[model samples]
Target: MDPPEQLALREVFTAACRAQRAEVLATAVRRFASAILTNLAARPVADLLADYFKPVALYAICELVGIPATQRAVVAESAETMAASMDGVLDPERRAAAIGSRTALSRVVDSCLRSSDGSGVLGHVARNHRRLDVPRSVLVHSFRLLLSPGYMSVATAAANAFVALRAHNLPLTCLSRDTGVDELLRYCGPVQALGRLCRSDFDFRGTPVRKGELVLALLGAANRDPERFPGADDIRLDRRPNPHLAFGWGTHSCLGTSTARLVLSAAFGRLADQFPAAELVSEPRYAVRAVVRAPEALPVRLTRGSEGAIR
Candidate 1:
């Protein structure tokens, strides 16, 4: 985050806190979930969860950031392109894809400038763009920051929820019923870790750290912390009190925290109502990322429905 964009994000965050409430986020998630359920009718929920969640989650963020709805696909494509390049296997095809996606995103930003309405994130940047303090590159990177952090988070989260349903054999009836959603979230926290560079020397749980030292805030460990959660090693889907840090803590908490909750809430609700007997055909290929931890590939099988119906 550059100084100028940093200034902009502070403004956006300040405005978001004052203007939008929590339920607004929840409503957005429900709408996204309904769309997924409709398109994924009779299909394995996990297979398509990532695909739908991205566009939906991206749109919600764009809307919140003040990006117009018309350019959602364009923003999502840019995000998807950026995400693909993170894999340790870079190649010509991947580079080409990213270049193309970046081109599209730039075009979207250009379009926003042309639009007289100017109502989205691009709108914010264009409307509030500074000549000296904030350069064009700075604004672009700042918008990219909002997209970069949450893409993998939302995708992994959707898949994590799908996996839990498979492992537990939870039924579709639960989606409509008043069941424990937080418990599932706590038990299978979508993110396994977050990054932090120690600001100063400190000791935590007998481990010593120094200033500027990079640290992995083990999310899996925190979620399963025995001190906070009894029997932390086990997954308690109906946990009474789940004080996990799946969304991190302090200043760097996920910017899309509310948006993330919405994506997961909607995704799981529809998934539970759709596929009740989905199971993993093979163990998920867990990602090796230090920050984002989730399955790179989660191949699963459907024993019921045409693809996910009642079999």
Candidate 2:
């Protein structure tokens, strides 16, 4: 990477840390938390917990990437259809949503770039984008990157942790507090897998990996690597020096990762506080998909909990 590129990334990182990234994530967290709470307060029997995590994550991602309101639905729809197409449900709505989302996201990013003021990530990314002459593909790439956090891995991790919590007679309420969320992320593998494309020839152990090939980094596998963690499968909430790779490493590292952690911390903290006695009544099933693999749908009865109105 050139010095200019390095400088650009550094600037963006600095700007991201300056509150834009945190703000975007906090906004998302608030929306998601409110959505769930509203549902709880209004509905009588609310239990499609994991599924509820998806749309909030999706909409938040759109806003973060500056996906134009005109095309936000399309981008969301297209991405969903693209995923579903592999499963044989290529609906026309998804196609339209995708195409529109891409277009809108592209335009909004452009507007953001032209207005750079070191004031917002939008302007910062725009200034750097123009300086770098970023391509349209980056818009799609960024959208995809931001899309996963709220609903997919982060939510799955929460669900899986919920399962583990119940199986061990642990309280879901503990998660709502600030205690043990980081350990939960480390132990549960919030992001089940991460991917990399070889930019240069490099050797993995003994095998030579040439440029332009896909490399799958199994975060779940690495987190469980015995040499790295003793009794790898065990969950030790007090575990330290974790060195877990729930978030990828290097330049292309996940931009929203810290933000994801914050959102999760808040959500789980609330869960711990609100439903201290909730219990799971069904066997949780896991799902596997390209790039991300883990539980897709988590169902629970909330069998025993505070006498709060659950939506």
Candidate 3:
């Protein structure tokens, strides 16, 4: 919280988090959207998620972060295994996985820094860190900050939205407006929780939270709270003023909010347009991971105009 660190934060936002990077955002969207549609069109009966959405998420995020093609699979695998540790269950296996992933990613990020071509987010952040007065260590950690959830959350959120759409028999016309995408994110966002370390003693609804304590905020529960959102349990496609915390609030809010919105809008919009009559072939089983609420497998039957394919 020094002046230099604050400046660094502002610089990072300016460099990589702006909404006007429409060309890059559009490319990421098109790459992933086309991949998803191609995979679906070819093998309609397969796990719509496994072969398409997950890879799309990984590739899009990596493209943004400038993660190399050679390192992507390892990074993706480690990041996913690391998510299991976020359930607040630090069993030995989970802890081991998380440690291994952190170490591997840190090394990869360091290598990326060494070869910085002054392109992409990672390169920009790397080149400007000294000017921003940000520590190299912090810049390295930012890799995980950007990549881990960037892949997991976007993929999960998109998949969850698809499931909700099919389950409720909501048609593709719903996504014609931005409100539609916002409501879908609120109803079925990927993140289950957000964690923070208490910096000082505080009262929460008359309960005392001591400093040095770890607090896990249940974002899913908050988004579903009926008091804040009437009919919170239901998907209200046109719900305006939806201040849902699918992304975190305040200074710690998601830096990629603009990019995520564009990616998702493009994703669901394409789904609605191309496969207007996509249907769930079976119950969508969620992954057992604690932090990210994504489908383990999504078996959906896609209808091209009038012809339907089975799972």
Query: Who wins the lDDT comparison?
Result: 3
The C-alpha TM-scores of every prediction are 0.70, 0.72, 0.90
lDDT for residue 132 in candidate 1, whole number 0-100: 32
Q: What overall lDDT goes with each candidate model?
A: 0.60, 0.56, 0.75
Tell me the lDDT of model 1 at 6.
Answer: 62
- Specify the poorest-scoring 10-residue window by lDDT in model 2: 81-90
lDDT of 3: 0.75
**Top candidate (TM-score):** 3
lDDT of 3 at 225: 90
Considering TM-score, which of the candidate structures 2 and 3 is the better prediction for this target? 3
lDDT of 1: 0.60
Off by over 4 Å in 2: 1-10, 21-35, 41-44, 55-120, 127-129, 136-140, 148-151, 173-179, 288-290, 303-311
Q: After superposition, how far is residue 308 of candidate 2 from its true place, in Å?
A: 16
Model 2 lDDT tens row, 1-311 = 32454566445545644545566566666667666755664444445443444554554555555554565565555454444333223255544545555455455455555553524445446555545544546643554545534335555566667666666665554454333565566667655554567879988899999998988777777878889887777766666667777766666556766655665665655555544455544576665454444565665543335534322
What shift in Å separates residue 161 of candidate 3 from its native position after superposition? 0.8
Q: What is the lDDT of residue 61 in candidate 1?
A: 70
Query: Which scores better on TM-score, 1 or 2?
Result: 2
Q: State which candidate, 1 or 3, has the greater TM-score.
A: 3
Models ranked on TM-score: 3, 2, 1
